[model samples]
Target: MQTWLVQHQKLLSQQLAQGRLAHAILLAGVAGAGKLSLANWLVQVVLCRQVQKNNDQGILSPCNSCKACRLYHQGSYPDFLSVTSDSKNIGVDDIRRISAFVETTAHLGKNKIVLLPMAEKMTTAAANALLKTLEEPGLSCVLILVSDDLDMLLPTITSRCRLYDIRPLSGQALLESLNRGQTQENLFANVSQLPELTDEQVHEQFRQFTARLLDFIIKRQNRGALLALLNENTYAFRWLEYMLVTMARSQYNWLSWSALRVKLVTAEGKSAATGAAPGDAIGQLPDSETIWQIYQLVVGCIKQLKSMVQVNAAYLSEKLLVDIETRLDK
Candidate 1:
């Protein structure tokens, strides 16, 4: 678990040592990037009783075996406050309750930690109420907000906090985690248990998947398209996520190489407005300002969909695709 969080830990420890820690931190990441886990670790570090007081720099480290760590693991830490979702939106009253709690001193650690998970889900009124607390954070108070949907958060709230963008564990790291005690042969055997799928079959499945996803996006324009895609199954959701990530990566690559004006003509004969197919002008990619905007929008939609904050996945998908096509003049 610590392996996935080593980078964040290092930065946080540096801050604690220098006594330059921000009163509030905003963690932005895709879902499953372990933002909540990092927040929990941070709370433990700030609240651990056995942490050395003499070493200002050393105080950053949390003794995982200490009583404080144990209590935190058990979810009974008195000083650590966590506000999470029970429903769609966090109400103004919730923020008020937190404000009331923050007025008191810590019962355990030297610091008071308030964690707001899915902070973007807080309603407009709730966010406004929290803004007051942010303006005047009490002594020893640390505000940590976890939001996968950074777009939904008010700009004022974001500007007040230092932002950390968390990312997924690399493939090698994931495999190592999954195969800790297992041999390579054993891992291969486990993989081999699944039937092999041919490339064509896989591509066909993906094509149909993309079609159904588009159907969902354009349901208002084409309602019947979503019926076959949605029998209360999770596959539709999973594929949408996969395609969004894939498209985002593709767009990023295009943008990165835009200085060359490299033209990449897909085998499908789709050409850019200038008649340069995707691969036609390999050394002359155009300016990427327009592509970057589309990329951000697509990523925002993905984050909203994953958090279940946006109800119209199909509609958003259709709009995004149309925008992309229009940008390319396809």
Candidate 2:
């Protein structure tokens, strides 16, 4: 586990020990920020019998060999449940089923836990149905909802859950953690060892790398080296594909921030009623309009590619690059 995440775990475990832990918890963070890992750690802490004896601070982890921990690892814990989405949305039926499960007594007389990943993907009807369960949770029942997008979840849902924002690991830290190898050889430079490739083969691989790189930039950078890459005609299609993937990743991570931003705006509006300026409510956050524009432009290009339309990839790539450049200028 990362350092920051470990700190969060310690704080949460303390709250649990004091019986002050909220019935619902929202783990908000970027895609690779280990939100799910922390959630799993929490489940162990909540389910571990030895955790109680140690005052919420055991030897770095739950005694994995214990009967409770063993059952959890094997996925045989009757009181523990997980709900995941299908398609783009988690349907009302899924929420109802989990809700029904929570209403029942725990088989081991332990806390009944419901872990919902991508909680923001729940449809309005589904969210509203789950709201009833949140509004009146069962005794010793806990709900842990993890989402990259908090905006899609109902305001009622947000209010019910105690939200914890998980910040992304710094780039330097992430790279260090990956620690691929100390050797100076570039991962992509060795072509002879790779299978013989034709012109079309090279183009496809170039396209894949371009897509991954674009996704990385959009999520992490405002305006930087990518502008130069966009100006060149060479490998333009691959670049555009990378931008599309990046945009998709951006949209995925924007969910929670969007929800939190809206909440701030609402609170700001209320503050304005008391003679304070509303501008103070929003503060100085990144321009969401630019984010949406980049997302839509990439999405438009993706749709165009899907239809096999007579479009010039270079022209589209340059156009979107200009749009991003303009947005960052402000």
Best candidate, lDDT:
2
Query: What Cα-based lDDT does every candidate model obtain?
Result: 0.61, 0.62
Encode model 2's per-residue lDDT on 1-330: one tens digit a residue: 766687788778778878898889999875546788899888888887776445444323677878888999898978899998655568889999888998888888888889999997777789889988888734578899998656656788989899989875444443354453332112221322111021345444443344333333334342234544544433444445443443344456743433333322322243211223444432332355655666566667656643442346556565766665565455
Worst 10 residues of 1 by lDDT: 189-198
| Lowest lDDT 10-residue stretch of candidate 2 | 189-198
Candidate 2 residue pairs that clash: 149-255, 149-256, 150-255, 150-256, 211-242, 215-246
